[model samples]
Target: MSFATPLYLCGPLREPRQMLADQQYSGHTSIHDDSMAEKLGFRAGPIEGPTHFSLFVPLLAEIWGQAWFERGCFSSHFQNMVVEGELVRAFVERPAPGTTRVRAWAEKADGTPVLEASASLGPDDGATLLDERMAKLRAPEKLVILSGLYVGMLGAEDEKVRMDAEQHMGDLYPFSLAQKLEGITENSPWYSDAASTPWGRAVIPLEMVSVLAEYTSKQAAFPVKQPVIGLFADQEIRMIDGPLFVGEDYLIRREIVALSESKRTESYWVRSRIYDASGETLKAEMLLNHATLKHSYADYEAEASA
Candidate 1:
């Protein structure tokens, strides 16, 4: 059946801090670190993206049953942070039979939608999809790998020295609340009514974390040979330590922790850690199968010229 089937999903998520604490104790440190979030300037531990995505799985199961995982494609952009005591909701819209579109968003008790997402699901046919096509186009040149090679080639010579947060904790991003709320949610009550809730305070969306990670990978090298690929395979939001207030300036720094070649897929895997202004690790990620800029249209042109 397509995602357009008559299926509806709705519910409220538990407290954000409790969830994050569980994730940290369980050794789930790939994303936000629950241990030192407050010290890092967060109101509380922030939730991981993957775990937040799962809020819809139950709804999918009701509609698609066991087949949801087999034929569904899910994608989400972290728009705003759902802090420690917020109530998040999930909804689905079915436009056509056998097709379903779902969305999730978190809000304060006053009903401000902080984070939002939309996903589509339908019958899976045995054919290559756009994502696969892109992968094929990216495979031959390996731009991501080449970028890593370039970094290694520099060997500390070109290392971009970053300011340590402990020594310089006050540096912030300076994004205003009004600006941060822009394009996030429509007529958000938090913005219009000055609503308060047990959810603490509004923070930056978790989706921004993903955006930062993608941007950092892009800036790690020069000449822009290959574009970084983002995979939302599995995300887990562990905590929402503190509020990332609007107009508050925050600093982010990334460091590559591990790089290795995959034996099975012959792809390169890169892991990076993101820290906030306090020098406390806010998020850590292991990006798999990122392509490097080894060859491009220029290489093809060179061959033609040769």
Candidate 2:
């Protein structure tokens, strides 16, 4: 809770897994599938970018204690693909006294950058990495793959989501919170032992915040052309009120806040707001850039020529 910290904090090297080989969406196998990844020019199915978020939690928690979970933010832009078995580590640029924001990142063992990020504690009004990026987005001149999508589009329904220790998260995340704890990069008793937590309830892990928010995302049904491949090009997860708890019910409302394109992909940004079970209290928020690969869309060339 104090700033008498070192210049930086380094975490143990971890090998995050690619558990999405069977991930399906838009009626097709996703980029996390080995065959799909090869067709799209990646060396292999890369680990989901947010998996790296776990490596930084222990370090940040040490710096800010339990508050890091209640009102902390981790904003990141993934820089390189990390296939399974590759070693990666997290680093935080220790903040000076009274500072709330600090730089954070991850890298492969040989020093290849995996992702670059910002970590901060709230009541924060500070701009995150995605906040800056979204601000600079000039409306893409043309969007072929994401043409069906528009900014401010809302999810089809309010989703009620929660993570139970033994419940499998569904196709996109195919594992339970209990299963994740078995191999998590940094394990904490607070994740499973309510008796040991300050909140008196077992809290969900930092990285699993992504899982909790995304658990029922398909209900949102923001219409993007599908059967095409996509990946997490960027992400920001923030806790507003406090730590999200395991087995606790929450409601999520989503909206497409922005859209853009590059030569290889078209991206739609969605912001999911998590509310307490009664749908009244704001608890956490996640901003994500779901970028769809252009070439992977069967109609990209055909539709462009038309």
Candidate 3:
């Protein structure tokens, strides 16, 4: 692919209401749940991190082509959260030719940073943003929510996950793509129409990819018994063999990568590998930092005080 070609000459497109998935799991009112978010001081539950990822698809496809879906890596560190109906836009500051990576970011019209990321097509594309971050991650200390999880802890067994056409996404993601789009603040055709592209089927949006790649997390429960609510502190999705088509089956294996803590929460990193149904060809991967709020776990307070 040529370097100078502009994916969006018109500049960033307005990203509209993206809040959809309701994370009612822990009942503590996470940013994913509207009522919970409002009570927690946010305007409304802020849109999920993975949902913001969809903003970059068109730009990636424009710069990398179909090959990108096979081996592209998008690594990001979330900077801030925006609630439903907030105006934001994705931008790619394309790299000068002969370079392997480019900087990407999203900002509200008022210029608040949303998330900053790096995108590249590779295995040879060099290290992704998450790769570098993971390399520097310090082992977590004095953890309560993620107490038993150690590096390299494996899942109980391999998991096979897929998205059904009827909007059923299985346990990890209770809502389907159709349902998500219903209240979608940003309406994009690329998410629903297969005929819009040369690909025979509709493309799976990153929001769906988030579910497609890790819906079976419970099968590999890492022994963290705390009922504390968890959220993605940071996440990276890397595609190896394809774009991860909709309604296709993929197998995944998870391992605890690292554990770390912040002032208010403790986090565990899980590295999940996605494979085609044949179980041989690797297709995609996700690196997730599941950060649990210490304030939400009563046990954490007791342990800290003791």
**Best lDDT among the predictions, by candidate number:** 2
lDDT per residue for candidate 2 within 1-306, as digits (tens), equals 655546889998889877778887767788888988898888888888988999999889888887898899999999999998999999999877678999999999999999999999888648888888889988998888888888888999999999999999988887899988988878889999999999999999878999898889989987777678889999999999979999999999999999988878899999999999999999999999999888888888888778
- Where does candidate 1 stray beyond 4 Å? 1-9, 16-35, 100-108, 122-306
lDDT of 1 by residue, 123-240 (tens): 3322223233223433323333233343222112111223211121111212223443343322234222324423333333333333333433434442323322122322222112
User: Candidate 1: how large is its RMSD?
Assistant: 16.2
Off by over 4 Å in 2: 1-6
Which lDDT values do the candidates have, in the order given? Answer: 0.37, 0.89, 0.74
Q: Which ten residues in a row have the lowest lDDT in candidate 3?
A: 2-11
Per-residue lDDT of model 3, residues 1-306, tens digit only: 555555431136465554344444533345577776565555766777877776787777777777666677888888898776677788886656555678888888898998888888777778878878888977666887777788889999999888755657654466777877675444456567777756667667665678776667878868875566677878888887767777788889998888889888788888899888878988888898888878777677788767
Candidate 3, pairs of clashing residues: 17-185, 70-240
Q: Alpha-carbon error at 267 in model 2, in Å?
A: 0.3
Error of 2 at 132 (Å): 1.2
Pick the TM-score winner: 2
Which 10 consecutive residues of model 2 have the lowest summed lDDT?
A: 1-10
Clashes of 2: 1
